[model samples]
Target: MILKRLQSIGMVFLFLFGLLLFPIRSHADSAAYVIDETGVFTSDQLLELNDLAEQVTNDRECGVYVVITKNMHGYSERDFAEGLFFNYDLGYGLKDNPSGIILAIDYNDRFYDVYSYGAAGDTFTTARLDSLNDLVYDYLVKDDWFGACKAFINKCDELLESTGYVYHTIQYTDPTIAPHIVETSPEQRRNEFLLRLPFAALGSSIVGGISVMVMRGRNKRTGLAKNADQYIVNNGVRLTQSRDMFINRTRSVTRIQRDTGGGGHGGGGHSYHSSGGTHSSGGRHF
Candidate 1:
């Protein structure tokens, strides 16, 4: 009995010691600033970038999101960024008037786009975004993923600190502009359709369930009251929710511009619009 007790104590101490010796691992997706879905960065690099991004985002009151994915999710760079931003709620200010920037990179396509919204758009103007893109172009081209991310975070901090960005009251026009002019190949459209079928089925199931419940309720009522206090009590409330599913190959466009923000090497032929808002923006292939 004495020997057994001693061994049990030793095992308990060893477990406690191991707990202190090993580091707790964290899931990368839990990190909001830098989401490396491509898994290219090491733990140390991700930790460093997350620290820097968090610090700067707090200081500037504008979020800096870096999303490096394997592919574009069958959508354009602009749409991917916009959808992720709103869907994930990636901004610093109010929901309606959010302020942030996203550097979305499609690793397989070797393409990247910089998108900014609210005050960040004005702060990171066409000129600023262009210059920012140029700053990371070389690093991306060379496959220096860590260097590119660090440079991106640092450059955003630099621009936000500077006081030269042009700010104007941009009056947004019909944000409903035309669909993408480029013809989406049949193969791409088919892939998008396949992706949406599950959602369509889910919606149909919900609507059918509601209809059946309504019909059953009517059948349960055998006779209607016809005297005093015959009126319905109206004590209970019924709520219904529905969503529209649009599966298409149309690209969103924003042709209006208010401020060019100033001085850059990269040129913008047409301004880009995001899916969630009418923010001023720009983009290009590396």
Candidate 2:
């Protein structure tokens, strides 16, 4: 039996050695967020973006992914992006809702899409995705691939923060909950503040000037009788007893035209290109 024991130990040793020689890529690894199949990003960039995505995913409880591929692999832009998300099983937690958002880039095809699934879909509504699509497209048009991915992560974080976890939690748990509405972003708010800033400044300046004048007027210590008679100079005192008459009033009406055309944002929604999966994407062709 000594020979049999030696054979078994030899097999065990080989198995252990093989594991060391070939390490498997697990989901727990650090670079799970940014998957670059095209070799577009350097090691340092991948790590940095991966960390950012991971932190956002954890804080938001929804995955944020940036997936770059050479081409769509013989599939349409929408099909390929959704397919990758599913086939890769990319998401957070093993729950029913494998909620995640993907910014898929097809470098060869000159096309890109921001796909959102499960709870992420509910949170990243069409309007928000459109905004992100526009933001990323600006970078991609300039061949700023790294900038696009970086901006994608940062914007996702910003959007998620504004809505809190309402979309991620409420929708998944109770379908009856009122949907989360991402009405405004920090950028939009800042723009509004800027628009009103000039008016605000003007009002403040006027108030300040008036206050100063009032203070100066109060400090003059007026001696009424000294100069009042000389200061009041009337240029020809002539009075005619005439009454002013009222004239007829005329009114002009201008018709206000209405625009029947819908907004650009109406083109997006929760679409199910195929069963077993659903996503929201306003694909951009740059």
Which one is best on lDDT?
2
- What global local distance difference test value does model 1 have? 0.69
The alpha-carbon root-mean-square deviation between model 1 and the true structure, to one decimal in Å, is: 18.6
**Tens-digit lDDT track of model 2 for 1-286:** 9999999988996786555334322323537788887788998999999999999898888889988877775556566666566655577755555678888888888889887776676567777888889999999999998899999999998888887743332123332222222233232344455566557757977998999999999989867565555665586445667788989989999999899774432223443322323444458789
Per-prediction TM-score, please? 0.52, 0.54
Would you list the clashing residue pairs of candidate 1? 180-251
Q: In model 1, which regions exceed 4 Å deviation?
A: 1-29, 164-286
Model 1 lDDT tens row, 1-286: 9999999988996786455333222222357788777788997888899899999898888888888877776676567665455544577766555678888787888888777766677577767777878888889888998898899999999888885443232323334323332333333355456556557757877998999999999888678657855464676445587788989888899989878776433434324344323322445566
Off by over 4 Å in 2: 1-30, 167-281
**Candidate 1: TM-score?**
0.52
- Ten residues in a row with the worst lDDT in model 2? 173-182
Candidate 1 shows a clash count of 1
